[model samples]
Target: MIKGFILIFLLGASATYCIAQHNKAKSAAIIVTGKVLSQADSNLVKELFFDGLHEKIVNNFQRASTNFNKVLEIDPANDAAMYELANIYHTQNQEADAERLIRMAVTVQPENNWYWLLLADIYKQTQNMAQLVPVFDELIRLSPANEDNYFDKANALLMQNKVNEATAVYNSIEKLYGSSEDLSNARQRILIQQGKPGKAAAELEKLVISNPSDLGNYLSLSEIYAKSGKRDQAIAVLQKAALADPANALVRLSLADHYRALNKPDDAFIELKVAFADPNLNIDDKVRIILSFFPQFADYKARAYADELASITAKTHPDDPKAFSVYGDVLYQEQKYSEAKEEYKKALVLNDQVYQIWEQVLRIDITESKFKDAITDGEAALAIFPNQAPLYLFSSIAYAQSGNHEKAIAYLKNAADLETENKDVISQIFSGMGDSYNALKRYSESDQAYEKALAADPDNSYTLNNYAYYLSLRGENLEKAAKMSKRSIELDPGNSSSEDTYAWILFRLKKYADALIWIEKAMISGKVVNAVQLEHYGDILFFLGNKEQALLQWTKARQAGSASEKLNQKINEKKYIE
Candidate 1:
């Protein structure tokens, strides 16, 4: 009965008569017969339909619904009005109302293909897969020659895991229009999902046999076999593909993948080398394969293989910047920083627009203490990516390292203004500002910068050590300096420089005995005690009344190549000058 009632209430019956015939109708009629009679105007229904469509287009759903409801009121079998109202409800996510109205619409105008498509779309949107199958069946009945409708029905069946029914739909497609690559692939996928790899492989084999000259079909079959864990079968199929087209890079790449999966890395590299040598294989694909080996770069053998592949890539695609980029990445991963920088520079010359390569160039320059290059490259990168905070930060670091404190502060302040969300970058900016201010002998500004740095990152050891050492040097805030210097040592226990700072702070606090103890500890902890540290130890000894030993220590400080004017005065006077 559901299928037979193609056009329910087809007669031009009066509204009262129709309503009286169905007492079980869910809702009251929106339009009374009196209104229809008054508006008994020409093309009244057509006017209302266009009005509804205009309202819907302008997003006036209430007016649109009113117009559509009036259309249905005058003519209860107005499928177009029902469809428009259903689309409105669907847009509002009222799927239940959408489904009900669309069902009525499709049933009222059985031959309207648009109405049936809308019904199918509503079912699909709601994921009402149980009901979806019947809608597609109705569509196929309405549009018998449309091949796409059958495919939709097959996909709907597949969504419900009804593999057998889905297979029947695919077979129907083949029967209607002879076999195609699309149909074969769809059937192969279904069979594979149904745990019928053998059948899936056979399905693809038919394509190869039907068109033996198509190398892609052979690769497709080999891929299916590989996915099914048939290593030997995959290799044999790819070998056949290679023999069919010996110059095909795709075949060589596939063979490499199979060999790599089988743990024959040597065989994989050989195949990759052959593939890389083929100019027909584009550089983008070669770069993708090279990047795919990134996860395995930690292994020495894998790194070696990647190195060899990069060499082949360079030889094959020497003019491409991406080739040099890949070569740089391999060298970067191996910690060959200098070599990596050269490769990155080569890539930059070919293409300077790639931000990642520019970043690499700057990173290696910074890491290898080539600050001049970092500043030059980072400045160029900034012209392209002006708002990039890290570029400003690296430029700041480069300027700071080169003893240009004013330039460093300018770059750090610029970076601080641009960086909002990243607290680490902000903290580093303020810390760099503190160091630059201290270098310029701006004590008040230096103090403020250190405070801001600590507020952002309270445990920044570098900032703590520098701030504390500067305070101790000025002979101010001795107690607070002692605390911060001690914290820095605690944060980095094995850092001899931090230990020396703490000892110097203790010396400034006039705790001579404690200062001597800490300075001795500094000397022992340090790998190679510097001249400043030796001088500090001499000062501590002199404070403890060991004048003779202090002179010997001061002489040693001079020999250690860090003798200041004060230290020379102290040794010549043979006493604590202060």
Candidate 2:
């Protein structure tokens, strides 16, 4: 009996093994051809699918597509193979083929999340908003708890101008995840886009009540109110936000804006001061606020506020070069040039790569008459930006101011060479060259450069005055010099320098009577008479045969510093010694 039981057990075990093998073969067949496949064919299809994936990864798209096609030929229902082929087509911008293949893949394996996502992306890429809606709907159905899928559906609906439907989707998200500021804001935007700002404001109000501690909600509501012209309502919302989050700098800024709009200048300034005092406010925003005060700079109160705000920016953002740079701009505009130069230098020490800052620093140095510093800084700037004509021009000015006429001419030539189609810059360069050459006693070159400068800018008063003065000093071209000097005076009436040049040119022509009148005008036109003007007046008076009065003027010229050596000789000799 034991032998018989053993044989029966063996037979039942063999039958169970056969049935399991048969079911496995049937599953493989469904995967391949929806019919039974031989074990060899199933293995080959699997091999091809993996090889296609490897080829795709290696960017061998043609080979990848070939292998995928072979796998699909062997197993027509292979959704993964279809998806891979669709990806290759998508990459090639064959969207129609991609769409057809991906749709087939989704249809074959409707529950494949990746397949649905690819289809949705394809719809989005094609801008087929209408088609994208159902794909996102399917995605939502597939992944019911996925919040991103709901957002995608809402966006698709919004693209179709289906505001109500989009709002419903956003509402669905809130239901799934509880109330959120993002959802509320999204709904608000949709309502606002639909021209129902009242509804939008209502939506944001709901968020504010739900999350009273969140200042962002209040700010959003205030913006909407402001945009809708409810100025008082906007101010009230911002005030509530500030009370809720007293430390928020952005809220304070918004409050300042609203207060200003309400025409309450004191309230506006108070809020602005609070906002600017906050260390948490970003440097860029502070810079913007400071810039807004530019138009109001003529008002003492506005100027003081701007100055205080700039100081705060410097303190809060000590390492930020922009902070100091912007402050320097404010001071420079106010004509506090020396202080502006210090600020720009501080900014450069922090960060020297900004070209605009370099420009500002050099400009301020020139304005403050820091000639040595300007030359040092301008040369460094030129090294970094050799092609910049403005840098060359600035460097030339620095060299000229420092009495390096040869170097000045070289730098000015470089500026003229680099400047194209900018007649103003070219004119300035030639004018500078004229000055440098004249200083070096290269009178012919100086005269040529001056002519070119006048050709470029006929109304250049500075050039006219300097050119006429140089010609008069040389005792050549007196008539032309007199005409240019007169034109310079006409262009810049009451300019002491032009008046002095005309008077000197008149003296050179031996018109002593005419020279006396202009020399006197030059001395009185300026707030202070310089040693040069006093000496010139002495010479004109002596030429007109007033020895005693001329001697008196010479003594005064000596009292003023910078009187020429000849003035001392003439004073000692008790006569004109020209």
Candidate 3:
């Protein structure tokens, strides 16, 4: 046996990242071979090899490499030791060394299944696909019954786009072990990629005969027929699947897909209803199928179908909270807030631990101006999830809306430390604190909180608009407020709230003509122009010496639910009032 130190350099390129702003390329290396020498003792070589394996298992790759090299020194033709060291080299990303050693090991131990497999793996990892097929072929010759070897060889060939060779490998698999779904599907894929859909259909047809009991095989065959524009043939094959098992729900789903492709949406809906009603199909699979088609359900008609399908899913799986939650999601998206709330309530009754479902219910309550209900529900949810920062933030908003700023402030402070790394959530909590402080007439605290919120997320348009508007209301920092409100409008282009805020800031700065332009833009935005916007428009007009129109707008503001104390005064006195 040869006993000389083999200098195994770990051949990985390392480049220093620039602190000096220049590329400094250098190759970093480590010596992997060992110094320990021994006579050709077979027993000692075996012990050292096992010791090397144990070291590798413990993640001590350097020591493992040392032991393996020592074993190889004791027995120069130790293919097992050579393979282990090659694996270490591969792990270290020393690809050249790994490939060389693995190749040598395979040559030394041609009959060893593992040596050939390692060589195959090395070839694959190096992207040297041209050499991989022969190694897998040798593995097959060595262990002909190993089915994985056949698949690996086919996959390797497919990687090279060797369509003929890959199909041949699949054919060989079928000839040796009979036609199977895996082999036939693999071959059909190659045929399809080769743009021979006709030949792909032939392959699946053969697989359908061999695997006659697998409904999946018939489905695949039907799809291939459809892909090849043989719609009639596809329907006939799906009919066979139905006759094969009259209760198979998947066949109904397949027919629905075919009918949709044929533009017979009504027929598709009928088949979809049949499929959704079948208990044989797993509900989880049904959920996945429906979600996959969500993009197609963007139109009102298809969305209604989606709602119907979601309803069927819920009734089919009445015990599953997820089913009701999905149904609520559909209704919520359609703006059927009341129906969505009922479905969400049903879901909570079944399982109230789901935070997102509670969040959805709370959002609807807030949207519908049910602040007391929102506050109550939020408190119950907080008792269950005490550490959730978003719940506290949302609950504080409800409290603030209910004119309970002290409760809102307490909740917002409690939320400050529970936040995760999401800066938007953190920013929103601070912004909520700002609003609560402003509502309580604590201007200094409100300013500090708004500053902190901007620090967390400088681009938050809500914080910009609110802080600017509050500063304008206090009649302080009019210049700063003008800048911030303008920025808010730039951030959310065409937003009525931001535009109204900008107009109000301009009015506070005594720029009446500029304020009038922005106020008119906000009024015509096609969105709901809230009472505050109308009141601001009246103030802007009054400042611009249009008292008649200004008083008219103030009345409109009061009529539109302005709850502002100065609004009635402005209309009755026929002048602008803050």
Candidate 4:
């Protein structure tokens, strides 16, 4: 409410405002060492005072203080000098000196609101609410039309925990100038802060009754009633608000909350659906309500209700990207991948600025094995967010699957650098890099990448299985591969891929009997048999001296759709190759 002085000119302005533009202080040289200069004797008082004004205007407070002090010594009852010196002292944090000087200024010029206002500030600094009341009272008497005086007085009263006095001040505002939001809100807040909810409720109720068109007053009143356990009264207030504003989204939202509190889901959902469908409700607010109030998608009934609301939100706000984004989230949670992608794409069309939405689109593309779509979306995302690690990782996966192993390795390397701290995530990136190198037939680079992956996260089951399998395929480091493969199986128990890698490593190690046990476990434990697992089983069988069974297994491998290059020759020769 007060503009604390900063510049030299503003201090002059304050002096000008207080004195109603008194004549500029003239400069004069006066030596006071000989005797104390009385007010009448020091005919150069105005000149010395103006010199002080000039010094203060230049922001030289020390010089200004000296000039004003001399003026007071000469003119003992100079109110203007007292006010100026008090302001300087207050700015220097000399509150006691400032208080005394300002108090004397107010006593000399009791009709000046500016002096009283400064006095009030000094009282505020000293935390003397008792003196502040009389100061503001005098300010109000001096300028009765200044509403700020009333607010200042009320706030000071509230600081003293004199809530009733504060309420009276607000009431006085209503009497002087009809009931207003500023007055009602201030009074109601103080009453509520004082633990007088009943008084707060009554004050709001009066506003609601006096101005039925003000939906905010009704909502505030309803909240108070609801918090006080007057559920029926709360609902009644919202119901009346609904009557006034039939299509009001906030009213519907309030009604929905009240119905939910009463355990009426059917009624609550009806109100919520209308509220969500209302375009007047800001899209962000709708998203906030759905996220904060609605149950997560894990709850079946709640998911259904939330899905319906999300659909309504999208329909009402077709152009708003957030509405479609949230609806896409609901679909994504329900595992409707294709539909979710379409909704997310719609959001991207409306606005491509949000990285999360683009990430969601790529995530769905990856999940559905849409490598082409994933590549395109990942490229687009990277164009906008070039440093996003997840985008790099996803793009690498898409490129890898599309047989662009060199590009995949590049993206993986960059992603590894970008995502450094999270060991699990970095391990995934390094493991991907290893796979890409292996695909490019750069086995040494592949092995180094795998080692880096393991260094980051020792328990990375995917890395363990893949690295061990790659080593087993090359017939090098079979002993270490066997250990890693076995640990991979232990870390992620019942995963057929890990089990198959372990069994194949055992076969390479010439532990054919142990290999036979694990191959059969992979076959029986898994829902579907892949060609590698079947071919590995054949190799183990032939090595264990079961040539006939090996041929039969090799034929099964050919039909299983991922048979190795040597599988056909092994079946034709009725012997395991490699």
RMSD to true structure for each model, in Å: 6.4, 10.8, 9.5, 8.6
Q: What lDDT tens digits, residue by residue, belong to model 3 across residues 199-268?
A: 8888777777877788888888888888888997998999898888876788988998899889998888
Better of 1 and 3 by TM-score: 1
Candidate 4 yields a Cα-based lDDT of 0.83
lDDT of 4 by residue, 393-498 (tens): 9999999999999999889978987997888878989899999999888999999999999999999999999999999899999889988998898899999888
Off by over 4 Å in 2: 1-128, 171-179, 190-203, 379-389, 413-421, 509-521, 538-555, 568-578
Ranking by lDDT: 2, 1, 4, 3
| Global fold similarity of model 2 (TM-score) | 0.76
Answer with 2 or 4, whichever has the higher lDDT. Answer: 2
lDDT of each: 0.84, 0.84, 0.82, 0.83
- Which candidate number has the best TM-score? 1
lDDT of 2 by residue, 447-486 (tens): 9999999999988899999999999988899999999999
* Superior by TM-score: candidate 1 or candidate 4: 1
Q: Give the lDDT of residue 118 in candidate 2.
A: 87
In candidate 1 the C-alpha lDDT for residue 497 amounts to 86
Better of 2 and 4 by TM-score: 4
Task: Find the 10 residues in a row with the least total lDDT in model 4.
Answer: 5-14
Using all chains and alpha carbons, the TM-scores for the candidates as numbered come to: 0.77, 0.76, 0.71, 0.76
> Which regions of candidate 4 fall more than 4 Å away from where they truly are?
1-139, 178-210, 293-295, 545-548, 562-565
